[model samples]
Target chain A: MHLAEGVLPVEWAAVWFAPAAATTVIGVRKLRSKTTQIPQRKALTGIMGASVFAISLMPIPVPVAGSVSHPCGTPLAAIVLGPFVSVVVAAVSLLFQALFFAHGGLSTWGANIVSEGVAGSLVGAGVFLGSRRLGLSLFASGFLAGFIGDLSVYAVTALELSLGLFGVSELGRQWVSLFGAFLPVQGPLALGRRCSPVGS
Target chain B: MSLRRIATVLVFVAVVAAAVTPTALHRGKGAGDYVGIDESIMEARAQEAGREARPPFINTDQGDLLLFVFTVGGLLAGGALGYLGRMVFVEGATSRERTRSMVDGR
Candidate 1:
């Protein structure tokens, strides 16, 4: 789920934006360096970008949480692409969602990117690589990556929201409350993401 | 069993589990609820600080119009990003070969 516009204080929003911008630039450079080596990198990035856009739009209701959230396809994208490229894809998709669908917010774009793009992709990639190093099959590794990646996004998002809303003093308590609320739906969604063909 | 087969079975089971879950049970606060929470908190904070909450820059009420603009904008942006990325990154022999093929009109 995306944090809406005007939800965060201007300073907090700017804080998130700076890092997102830095990481995006880094990702772009990485992509440029890899393009010559990978034959279908461009096509794959485009396809994954579009897929991230579409998949994020499909909201699945989580019965126990009394809430609905969509699966973040970033982990799968990170697996196919790399973490940097996945960030680009996520930024593009989240931008569209914020602008066109009102699903996310313009001011909150940086925060969303940090949570869904950078953190999600990096965590997913790290987990995937770690799993592979453990001699796990590709499918199993991908599953773990997708599952962890999906959950991490929400976890980070919870922290961001709590920080913005409650400030530093009550940050921990607020984050835990919000994160707990998200778990019921996020858990099942993570599992579904892990098991999906794209995730594996 | 092959890893692929195991993955497929896992996927099937997950799908079934998701399908069987009742929508009513999941019918709690949506993301919008969080936004509301932020608004209230910010307002309280503003009151404590003796300041006003910052307003949004854009007209958030124009949902439909924004969606249309964003859709068109997103597609163009994504396409342009992809194209530019290809130009900058995909160079050297493969690019030369593709260019030669096109130039030959074959």
Candidate 2:
């Protein structure tokens, strides 16, 4: 769900930027406070950041979509670190990808972060916490968190594209199409992600 | 075990099998079948919306650059994980031991 450069209009990009920046600031502060409380978490955070970076960069093939797609590793990070800190991890990873690999664009960085970082982390963590509260075991909760959160990233990206690029009149149809484009490819990858949180 | 636990295990195994079975069953398929959807689908849709992907500030799409970047990223990730493995894993175990000792003393 890395929206490439020039994909989202300037106004829409800035609209996404506000929340992304806000979350990032809060995430950084939360991470710093946590590190002060538990020094070991600082190193763990770095390792998780690097893991998210490398894991998302790998493109896996899906015969159903007849194409390859990457898995969002934010869920695992969120599961390990807190969700807010996971946002920072994702932002760092997305920024690196944008700068070095040209995978995502600087212009669309806000949108990408909003989709992958904010949406993925919060939803993944929320689902995991919710499942646990409902008395589910660790493994089951992790699997639900990873799978559902992974799918939600694409869903938000599709919504962003529909709102920014396409006409409102055709919004529903375009959103579904864009979301569907990723569904088949992402489903199996999401299944794969189910193991990431628990096995890590 | 309860039927629910057994079912969960079965589903987990099935998912794992589903992920791996395809590659094992269809070895040596055409390379075009594996093109990334980011390029094939996302980019195409963006074009249809009248927006084109511009060249990035540092375009690693050039020869060998992306590969080099991936190699560096992999090394950094591996090194960071290796260096912190003891702190993250061993420390957790040590903490667990400390808690167990405290509880036993109590």
Candidate 3:
């Protein structure tokens, strides 16, 4: 779930926004460069963006933790579209979510993008590439990519929230607390995401 | 049905069952009571400070109107950008082939 608007101090939000903006620029450049190959890729990107929008909206409640959250599709996007393009897709999806669903806040958009888009995409691509290099089958690599990508998003979110709310002094404790609260729901969601053939 | 088909159906049934059973069993606590990460952060902050920390921006009637405007604007901007990006970058083989064929015929 995205941090609500005004949850983070303005400074912290700005701080996170910097990297997200940078990556988005890079992604756009990359997309432009790759546009010559096939129109299908562009179509795929638009379709994937819609998929991410839909998937992120459906929050399933985890009975164990009494928390509700949705599975992120960043890993799948990164695996198909590359990390940079994935970041753009995430940003677009998140922007719509904030505007339409009130799931995330506009003020904290940067932080959410950083956590879900940047961290999730990069880590997912790295894991998928690494798994392929290690001789894993495509299905196995994709599963790991999606599973770890989902978890990493939450981890990054935990870190961001902790830093914003608790500052540098109590970062560790706060991260753990927030992460723990996220785990019960996130863990199952991640597994389900990995097992689902359509998304992974 | 094949095993794969059976498995898919079973999975679908299980998911539906899981989603419905929980809500049926648990009542009184509103859906919002389920602590999302955003609410959890707010609760934690409020606990430490001994005061409620309200969300900075919330949805209002005016805000919804603004959001609708933004959504339409974003959609237009995204579409324009996508079209421009494709025009500038994409070189379809069929179009190139067609051009070559036309030149050769001429």
Candidate 4:
């Protein structure tokens, strides 16, 4: 769900900064549980960021659209690094994508970061934690976590595109009138935990 | 053409190609709307609402399934990376010790 440049614009994106900044703080603070040093943490961050880009490179064909949705790599980053570091991983990877792939634009970086970063957190905390608590296998937990992460981002993407400044087209104004209507369809897919096998 | 001129021409071509590619793809879908929604919106809504009242199509079922698959694949790939990183770290640790011992003539 790479937002095209000026989709939501910089002023709107600025609102995302507070959440991302808070996530970063929580991430660094949570490192107390690990024996790893700052250098190692930095290294993990870089590696996870690269993995996000690399995974997206392996295209998944979406035959209906004739264009595939590239992997967001959010859940992967969360699993590799702690869920908290996912915010950092997403923010960094989106930054890189903005510059290199022109996937997301400078003006929309913060918005992309928040939407993606939050998705990673949802999977990391919700599916992973909840399933594991219920004694689900690591593989199942991981699968569910990732499923939630991807759907959450898609819902967010649909929300921002359908209702945000870019808005539904004037021709489709009647449908746009029901902007909030899709929430029911979108929300459960975004949050529901579908059962997956022990290992994906 | 001089190298600089050739480079300029190539850059221009690249930019134009990039711009037109998405347009070409969008037209293929029979979707003219600027906000890029996939075909499902049309399939689900077209007949019921007719073309005039078409909303952005979201095939939540297929979309969710595709999304889950992407995540599963991404996670496995990330775990592999994490595994390799740990291996490289271990190798680096030992290699560093070996170099230290060599320089000291131990």
| Top-TM-score structure, candidate number | 2
Tell me the chain A TM-score of model 2: 0.95
lDDT of 2 by residue, A109-171 (tens): 999998889999999999899988977788888887888788888889898889888867889
Give candidate 3 misplaced runs (Cα > 4 Å).
B1-35, B41-106
CA lDDT of every candidate: 0.72, 0.82, 0.74, 0.54
lDDT of 4 by residue, B1-106 (tens): 7775575457446534543444344445533232223233422232333322222122222436546644664675577577757745876578779999999998
Tell me how far the alpha carbon of residue A165 in candidate 3 is from the true structure, in angstroms, after superposition.
0.8
Tell me the DockQ of each model, to 2 decimals.
Answer: 0.12, 0.40, 0.14, 0.04
lDDT of 1 at B106: 75
Better of 1 and 2 by DockQ: 2
Sort candidate 4 into its docking category: incorrect
> Which residue ranges in model 2 land beyond 4 Å of their true spot?
A196-200, B1-32, B91-106
Report the lDDT tens digits of candidate 3 across residue range A1-200: 57767677789989989998999999988877776676567767875676676576666676655667778888888998999999999999888778656677787789889988998899999999997897666876787788778889989998887887778999999888777656656776777777787553
Winner by lDDT: 2
Error of 1 at B87 (Å): 16
Per-residue lDDT of model 1, residues A130-195, tens digit only:
979977778777877888788788888888877877789998887787766566567776776666
Colliding pairs, model 1 = A62-B26, A63-B25, A63-B26, A66-B26, A66-B28
What is the Cα-based TM-score of model 3?
A: 0.72
Can you list the residue pairs that collide in candidate 3?
A35-B90
Better of 2 and 3 by TM-score: 2
Q: What lDDT would candidate 1 get against the real structure?
A: 0.72
Task: Say which docking band candidate 1 falls in.
Answer: incorrect
Clashing residue pairs in candidate 2 are: none
